[model samples]
Structures are given as structure tokens and as C-alpha cells.
Target: MKLLFIALAFIGVAVRFAVFVSPIHEFASQRVEFSVPTNSWRRVSEGLFLYGIGVDPYLGDTFHETPFCLGLLSKLHRVNPLIIDILFPVADILAAILLYLFAQNFLEQKVVEEHKVKTSFKKESQILMLSFDCIRTVPKLVVLCYLCNPLTVGSCWAKTTTVFTNLLMAAMLLSASQGACRFYRYISLVFLALCTYQTFYYGLLFPALHLYFENFAGSKTHCRSRGDSVFGLLMDGLVFIGSFAIMLVVSSHIMGSWTFLRGVYGFLISAPDLTPNIGLYWYFFTEMFEQFRSFFIWVFLINICIYSIPVSVKLRHHPMFALFTLLPLITAFKPYPSYGDIGLYLSLFAVWRHLIPQMRQTLIVSVMLVLAATVFPVLWKLWLEVGSANANFIYAITLVLATSQVFFVTDVMLAHEKREWHLKHGVETVDKTGKRLELHLQ
Candidate 1:
């Protein structure tokens, strides 16, 4: 097990290193110029030295950048898109480590607290709980889903989705999952707050996720005092407010008006009806839907099937599941979705692990995955014809299907019983006369 863990760690590091050193001539070589207040620090830094020339360093006519994002970027004396991009895979790996730590803590918590229940239930419920327990090792499954995902790898060169998602995931682990106390909770919120500012669409979702994890995951029930529980909630809210305010102020200052602010809010409140090309919202949803509509929904359904596992039925009362389900619908405010993003993908994987103990349930999920993978792309091609050839169409499809694949693979691991088999055989041993004999398997 140690060897396996080490090997996985090495692979994650190597992948990140490759991406970090990968040529950034294309990314840096783009001749576009200008600055958003959110990035005013870069302008200030360059201007102070009178070093950077020919790059458009103007704060454009709108609050083009979120404030904290600007402030954070401003602090950096150097702007290397290449270095920034490389940081993501490293962050992803860090998130994986955090996840492992959390899982170990969770298992330990269950053992100490004995989250165990009576084995006897109605025939159906018994099957359900067993399956749920069987999938207990699922959080580890999430680690793999995050690490080896092709879409995640591909996006390394495209953007910093991995880094932000990993930060958010760590936030979930610290704030939502059981562990060492207040420090982690605060740490989680701080990271979440900064991350939210970076991408407004993701901003609201972070708070919502913590709310879900707190209430839905086992955390809600574990609180020792109302104040402790409430503290977590308040911290997340504070981060949200602080981050959003920074974004707004910076954007307004940069743009010389509140137009972007209004537009951002407009996107949140209204859902207009128009041709895919006319309304941005309409285009976002339809294009996003059309690109990977068939596959994403199918994969989601497979997760649903995994949830139907007899064991997972007992966890129906869990707050995490509810948070996971509602989060996507709410966060996808404008209709454009990134399946490759960690938020949706990791949550779906969590659901899959929650549901994987029942063979009947698992088998059904398997079928759905196979079918979705095969059919989703074909449907996307058809949607493209209806919508006309969209230059950004492939990106949309890739994001959606990539998200589905993350969840689908997580589902597979949830249904897996390999870990249980290892435990049963007592991989631990005692040696007598240099002849090893299994302890528990004896």
C-alpha cells in the first residue's frame, strides 16, 4: 500500500513538472496588451521600473478584473504565464495529498466514534448499508479521478482550473469533512475566498458547497457546540463577502463605472429566451448543453444509479449529497459548464463512491457509463450542425464530457471491492523463523 501510494505520488509530480516546463511561447507570445484593475499591480510594478514596454497596460473601460484577483496579481513583481500555469498540476497533487490525509482522518474518526450501525435491517436496507460501507474507501477514489483525468491534464496548458479546483477541494476537506479543528476551517475559507474572486461564477458555489458539506456530510451531526458549527458557516460567508466586494471595487475602479458589475449581476438574475446566437445566456446554455448534452446527463444518471446501491441508501440523510446535487444547478448560473472543473467532477465522484457497494447497482452504473461514452460525442456532432459551426464548440464538448468521465471513473472505483479483499486477507503479517504468516487471515 505504501509502495502504491508512493508510486501514485511520483506520477502526479512528474506530470505536473512536464506541464510546468512545457513551452509557453504560445501563451506568452500573444501580443495582446492592457490591464484590468484586478491586475493593476502588474502595471504598477512595470511602470515603477519602466521595464515592460509594448504590452497594453491600460485599465480598460470596464471593471475588467475582480479586485482580489488584481490585488493578488499586483503583489507579484514578475508575471510569468508559464510559471503560473505550471503551478496548477502541483496544486492538484497537493489537493490529492490533502484528500488522503482527510480520508485517513475520516476512517480514524469512524473507528473512534464507531459510525457503525446494526447489521440487521429490512432485507433491502441491509444490502444498502453494506454497499455504502464497501465504498468507504471512495474519497481515495476521488484522488485518482482528480489526478489521472485526461481533461484535467489537457486543461493544464489551457487555464488554471486544476489549481483553483484543488484549493476548493481542500477547503471542502477542511471545512466540510471531519478533521483537526478551527485552523483548518479558517484556512479552507481563506483559500476558497481568493479562489472565488478569481472566477465569479465559481464564487457563489464555494459557499454553497461548504453549506452542503456541513449540513449534508456527517459534519453537521458531529459538532460539539452550536457556536463551533456556526463559526464554520460564518467564516465561509465572510470570505464570500470579502472576496466579492474586492472584485466589485476593483472592477468598478478599473472600468470607471459599474457596468461589468451590473452585467455580472444581470447574468445571475435573468434567464432570457433567444436564439443560441442572440442571447449570451441562451447561447451559453444551449451551446454548453449541445456540446456534451447526451454524455453528461448519462454519466450523471450513472452516479444516480451508484447512489441506489443498497449501502448508500443509509447515507441518504447525509448533507454532503444534497450539497453536491444542488451545487451544480445553482453554480451553473449562466448555463456554460466546465465538466473538467474540479467542483462538479469531484462532487460527482463523491456520489459514485457513496453508491458503489451493491453489485446490482454497480452493474447498472457500468452500463450507463459505457453507453454515455459511446453516444455523447455523436449527439454533440448533431448539436453542432443545428447550432452552426461554433469555433468554441469543441472546448464546450471537452469540458462537459471530461466532467462526466471523472464522475464515471469514480463510480467504477466506488463499486470496486479490491480494498476490502486486501483487508480480508490481512496483508499485515507476523514472521516466525523467517516464515511469514498472515495475522488476521490466520
Candidate 2:
């Protein structure tokens, strides 16, 4: 199994290297599904060029990456363009490896927790508990799913900066899984800060991380008191904020101004660029009335931000699951999402494979997603290259894709609830009176 995993990793690397050298990468980079204004390597190149010529990259609307990212890439490009070319594939494989480690650690922790509570569960629920073999197997499957996922591969091939974001997220998850260690806790928050700095939407993950560490602190100290929870939360929050502030200070020094904030985060919040992508933001805002744009913009932005609250509350005991669910929501609704965002969340589905049998809408959601992926490029070609279709065609598919993702998230959440219920109440579907009892998520 170890040898097979290594071989698969090599194949993943070889495939990415092959794609990087192929003409297909140019076309992949151009695809709206893979590249957006925020993450596009083309935009990164444009920004680097402007910086090299002693011009502010943020002077216009070209670049939307953080000053830190711009500075790092600029140095790498100066060293050798091939370094930049090679980094994406390396980052992608590293992300996969991190995810594998996270899965292993998290599953181990889960087994220990379940073992402690096994007596509370009905005897029938024992069948649903994770088998010893599963803990050993699922981590490799997680890496396999991530490395072999088409969206991940295409994102790497396109050389989008989302690759780095995914890598940081993976590192954050792996660190968070080891939250019992003080060093790991600090490292996790720093990685989270970096992710949030690059993409503003990721800041929402702070609540989930806080919950995770709070739970960990309670478990480790055997103290579930309110004061202890609050103290832990305060400490973690301070570390996250300090890390983020340090990045901002460094970015200001690097750029000699704070203009990158307006260029990077402002672009994300304002939805200023309407170049169509997989997200729901562009088309609606593009055709929106000029007068009502501000009102609806707040509405839309609030729509994305508000989910973190209820999802955190509902999944408080399962902070990792909350993180998993919120990621796809961000991908589906954020202002400038791409296939890479979709890829990140899809790969994470491997972590919850135990819930698959309980999920009801998986088939329909899978079909919708596959159908949307198949039609997205077709509609784009018809609308742009062939001129037979219009923006409606693309927007319609985006809506379908978004709806499918929502269904997918909800299905998983429901599956989790059902699994928990079955564990406590047994797997029987009949009531005391012998009538069938249905489980409804609402």
C-alpha cells in the first residue's frame, strides 16, 4: 500500500509536469472555470511585470493578489521562470500529502473519541462505527482522491494561485488536527491567517478553528467549564489576529503602501470584475440595476458571511465537519470562485466517506455536477467563440452547478445527523408502535 501510494504520487507529479509542458496549459489557464481575476497566473504575471518596471501593480484593475504573494513570486520569477512553473505541481502534491496526514490524525482522534462513548450507543450502531481497517485505509484514499481529482489537476496545470491557497489550507487542517500541541496550535492559526490574508472569505474559518481548539483544550485538560472555553478562544483569537497583522505590516513594507488591500481584498468584496466564472456573483451583479447594486451587494455579501454563524452553531461539536461544509459554500457563492475551490472541497469528501451510505441526494447531486462540468465549456464556447449562445447559457450552468453544490453540502450534513441519530437510537426505522418513522433534517 505504501509503494502504491508513492507510485500514485509520482504519477500525479508526472501528469502535472506533462501538462505544464503541453500547449494545453495555455488553454487551461484561459478557461473561466480554472482562472479568475483573483487567482489567474496571467494576472500574476501582469502584476510582476508592472512591479519589475517600477510601477504599482495595483494602480489599475489587473492584479488581485496580496503584496506578499506578489513579492514572493516576483523573486522566484527573477531567479528562473522554471521555478515558478515547477512550484505549482510541487505545491499540489504537498497539499495532498498534508491532507493524507490530516485524515490519518483526525480519524485516529475520532476512533478514540468514539471508543470513549461507545457504551452510550445502541448495539446496532456498533456496525456503523469505523472499523480498524478503515482508519488505515481512508488516509491513502483521501490523498488519492485529491491528487487524481480533475479540478485539482487542471488548477495545477493552469498554474492558478489557488494552488497555494489550497496548500496553506491543507497545512492549516493538518496542524489543527494536532491542536493538542501548543506549537501545532500556533502553526495552525498562522496558516489560517495566511489563507485569510490571501482570500478574504477564508477568514470565516476562524470560528470553526476556534471551536476545534476549544474542544481540544476541553478534552486535553478534562475541563469543560465556560471560563476555560472562553480563555482558549481568546488565546487562539489573539494568535490569529497577531499573525494576520504581522502579514499586513510586512505587506505594507513590501509595497511601500497599503494599496494592495484595495487591489486585492476590495476587488474580492466589490465584485468589480464581471468576467464570468463558476461563482454566482458576476452575472446577477452585471445585469443588476445601477441604483440597487449597493443594496443587493450588501445582501449578497451578507448572504455569504451569515452561513458561518449557523453552521458553526450547528456543527460546534464537529468543527472539522463545519470547516468542510463551509468551504464548498464559499466556493459556490464567493465573488470570484474557480474550479480549484471546487476541487478543494470535493477532495475533502473522502474524509467523510463513512457518511456516504446515509446520504440520499448523492446520485442526483453527482449527476448535476457532472452535467454542469460537461456543459460549462460547451456553453462558454458557444457564447464566446461560436456566438450561437449568450451569457444566459453560461449563467444558467453556473446556477445549476451552485444548486448542485448546495444539495451536496446539505446531503452530507443530513447524512452526518442521521449517522449520529442512529448511533444513539439504534438503526431501527420503526417507532415503538411499529409505524415507520422518517428522518427529516428540518
Strongest candidate by lDDT: 2
Q: lDDT, candidate 1, residue 156? A: 45
Deviation from native of the Cα of residue 174 in model 1, angstroms: 2.2
Q: Please list all clashing residue pairs in model 2, or write none if there are none.
A: none
User: lDDT values of the candidates?
Assistant: 0.44, 0.90
Worst 10 residues of 2 by lDDT: 12-21
Counting clashing residue pairs in each candidate, in order, gives: 18, 0
Candidate 1, residues 1-442, lDDT tens digits: the string is 6477557657756765664566642342121111112222233344323223322233333223343333344444366644554555666667666766655555445443323533322333333333434234555555666566543544443443334544565656545455445455556556656555554444444534454445433444664467755876677677657755775686667545665554334332332222222112444445554667556544543433343233233333333443344333333322323323433344345533534442233554445434543444444455565664453554344444344444444444333333233333433434667676531211
lDDT of 2 at 205: 91
Taking the tens digit of each residue's C-alpha lDDT, what string does model 2 give over 70-121?
9999999999998998899999999999999999999999988998999999
Given candidate 1, what's the lDDT at residue 133?
A: 46
